[model samples]
Target chain A: DAGITQSPRHKVTETGTPVTLRCHQTENHRYMYWYRQDPGHGLRLIHYSYGVKDTDKGEVSDGYSVSRSKTEDFLLTLESATSSQTSVYFCAISEAGENQPQHFGDGTRLSIL
Target chain B: AQSVAQPEDQVNVAEGNPLTVKCTYSVSGNPYLFWYVQYPNRGLQFLLKYITGDNLVKGSYGFEAEFNKSQTSFHLKKPSALVSDSALYFCAVRRPRGNQFYFGTGTSLTVIP
Candidate 1:
């Protein structure tokens, strides 16, 4: 409940379709991240942004893109969805950098058929 | 590359019994460790963290963790378990000078009544 909100709590789309997940935060934190959670895989970082227009890839960044035009909003886009990309995506924010604990949003459950 | 491991897939304990969730980590320099709990259909809630100083760190919800450098372990523990404590627990390690966090596969804790 860290003042974070994620749009489209649940979404279902077909393969090859494009999907975008939004993360909005009111806390004005310095860092925001996108992660995906899957069975037997836990949570894996997909992308992160330290500031507006500053982004970086993570371990599992393939087939996904992200944008942060403003501090309060971070968007994760799946250019072409696939069955293997179905998972629960979470957004997190922290006041400080990696030293501090992150607060998470409720998450978006996305399914690709 | 920093990583964390939660060896157990699930742990069962009777209510009022002591509970422990194991976590191990590998990092280059000093490690920043964290623990979180996730209820069904909810976001992760922060439990405790090991930054520096004392080997033992206390956190929300009557939870605590001991950071043992020799063992490279930061295990979440509670003196007595409760039915409400039944949930999925995740352990994570934060990379230095970055916002990347690596999470474990998660351990399901079931506190029997």
Candidate 2:
């Protein structure tokens, strides 16, 4: 296990509501990423942070925003929840190098009604 | 664009029989390959990775992968299968010096008792 924790294991909310998921890592890795997993889509990257306050958009960054204020905490926010945003979210951390394998948190299951 | 592909959506093998999951990648420059397994309702677990050196890479849970650069494939294989080995397997690829990783849709493996 990689000392990674994801808060709010499960949540169900109505459309147009705001939703935020948190990912905390004990390991002081230099990179953190947020991804959504759906049936047949595998895992799609939403956003990533290379360092404190340094972030970049991923392939599917639309409708989602992320902030990394500190080295250990990364937050993913959905300004307005939509039914299409319902999916299992996962957070992963890796060392600075490209060859390093990523360590993942359990994940957050979110559903929009 | 850099990408990974798992040709099979599902694979089934009887207990004690040899099992294999196929993975092929397309990336510019030297690519880093990795395999991960995910149990139901859990995060992705690192299995094995091929960064450099030998073509055969051994990973967790008695699994090994063969990296064939000529074929542009990294296939996961186990000598014998177990019922507990059933899970979703994903293949990923990352380009050299790149921070982002592209993953496959995932292959569901079912090892029957």
Candidate 3:
């Protein structure tokens, strides 16, 4: 509903396989973020990109990586999928302002076996 | 280090009755507090935030939260509950001077009709 779309709404993968998720926004916001939601963990930031080719790791960035090639496209990759990494992933974007709040995409449900 | 706490795992109320969800935060300096709601299989939606304004902050869906700096709390409130209001609620906090925020485990609200 935030003019954001996430690809592969549901994904099933095997352990050790590689997976990539894409987040595209129509708003062309400057800040984009990747977050994972798990039971009892709420939402934890995995990575954030403030501009094209400018990315930073978040609290739970281990084993996960992200790339922002352009303003509207932010990609997340799992080099080696693990069952423990199975969770819901959300993409958020915000205007280029210090006090601007975030707008979220619908999210992707990933399951690794 | 910054953190948010949602002590109650769940909150229940009847329709037409007042409802509240408790939230407490700990951070250095003036902290930015936020509330978000998550519907099943959807992304988290921004409800409201306490930046630097009056103690009480109002948001969408007739929801409001009171920020108490003395208690380090920002509890969300509603004058009347509705069945549609039942969902997972989260409290988040961040320092205005920083880029990241810490989220609570979340509280599930159930409004009985």
TM-score top scorer: 2
Q: Can you give the TM-score per candidate against the true fold? A: 0.98, 0.99, 0.97
Each prediction's RMSD over C-alphas, in Å, is 0.9, 0.6, 1.0
Q: Give the lowest summed-lDDT range of ten residues in model 3 chain B.
A: B93-102
Q: For the second chain of model 2, what is the TM-score against the true structure's chain B?
A: 0.98
lDDT of 3 by residue, A1-113 (tens): 68999999999999999999999999989999999999888889999998999999999999999999889999999999999899999999888755667888999999999
Off by over 4 Å in 3: none
Q: What clash count goes with each model?
A: 0, 0, 0
Ranking by lDDT: 2, 1, 3
Residue B87 of model 1, lDDT score: 99
- CAPRI quality level assigned to candidate 3 from its DockQ score: medium
Candidate 2 residue spans exceeding 4 A from truth: none
Evaluated on CA atoms against the true complex, candidate 2 attains a DockQ of: 0.89
lDDT (10s digit) by residue, model 1, range B1-113:
67789999999999999999999998878878999999999889888888899999999889999999999999999999999999999999886785688899999999999
Evaluate every candidate with DockQ and list the scores.
Answer: 0.87, 0.89, 0.70
TM-score of chain B of each: 0.97, 0.98, 0.98
lDDT of 2 at A108: 99
Candidate 2 interface CA RMSD, Å: 0.5
Error of 1 at B97 (Å): 1.7
Q: Model 1, residue B99: displacement in angstroms?
A: 2.1
Clashing pairs in 2: none
